[model samples]
Target: MSPSLFTSLDVKSGGGTAVFSFLILLLLKMAFDTFGYKMGMNPWPGVFGWYCNPAYRLFDFLLGYTGFLVLEKTDLKVSSWKISVIQCVTLVFYFAACHLFDKQWVPAPFILLTLVLIFAFTLPGGIFNAIFGNRVLTHLGNISFELYIVHQVNINLMNHTLLKWTGNNHLLVFFMLLVISWLMAEFFSLNPIKRFVTKSIYKSKIFI
Candidate 1:
């Protein structure tokens, strides 16, 4: 569940470990999916209905710690562009490998490229901070935790209700889910509820 206790090590080492874990999880998921498809089986376990599978749990744990390690190690003088670059390269390689091996990898490259573009956009701000001694992307980075948490719940709830009522229209459902989730995240992040919950949990050190 929680990362190993040793995850509190130096940020760079922790980050490297987290990234390694993520890559391992991603590869494992691909292997599982491949084997499942070949055998005509569902890839995810039944409990949690697709959310709390071993692959997802492993990746989520690594990603959460990666963010923590990045925040811990961040310095105004040092650019975080290197981490972004490494993330992008790893994502690209993972997708490329999937595409090479799987006939169903059509969406993998597109998804990975979108993530790479997002990281690339942040790279400039990181470079500016390193050169001009300003924390340009600090605020954007800070809200990311709240955004991640809120977005997933919003998306899942919206998708489930819409599908139940309207039946399956995949593209329409996806766009609606995306728009609703982003709006919900933005709204919730600006409200006092966000601050109250975050402070009550993280500040109180009750759920660390």
Candidate 2:
């Protein structure tokens, strides 16, 4: 999670190569899944059935590499509005692609479109960073891992409790979850107890 990890020489070299390999593997897995379903054959069986699909391994591999690449390549500083817009667009495209091409394998056209969108959205930030430097981006990057860890637990608890009281108001639940997750992330990031625990566990290499 440390920003330093992203820019390490090892990551830039091996990590990038690993990511590209994983993407290729993922395409292979999708092919397998499609073939299996079409032929009415259950190719994978037993416990760990899900992992039998090559897709899962490819995904994990991609995440490992792409995450490092993103950290290394992008300025972490971005306005919330810009971040939200990118997220919304990405989600829309992902769902649209899924719905439109459910039976088809990952369409090359959609993949190319996605890559174009990513580069386009990133250009403004790249230009700004060239002129203004990356101080804001680096600071913003620090909070990301902490936010990821805290948000899910905070949201899940708030969602369940709110549902019991409010009779399934999705909007209210969503907003509350967002607000509470942010607050919890902020709190945990600063809390002495949490810091102590995190450092202790990390030092021991016991949590992973």
Best by TM-score: 2
Highest lDDT against the true fold, candidate: 2
- Per-residue error for 128 in candidate 2, Å, reads 12
Q: How close is candidate 1 to the true structure, as a TM-score?
A: 0.44
Residue 98's lDDT in candidate 2 = 70
Each model's TM-score, in the order given? Answer: 0.44, 0.47
Candidate 2: tens digits of C-alpha lDDT, residues 188-208: 667695668557754454433
Q: Per-model C-alpha lDDT, please?
A: 0.52, 0.53
Error of 1 at 70 (Å): 7.2
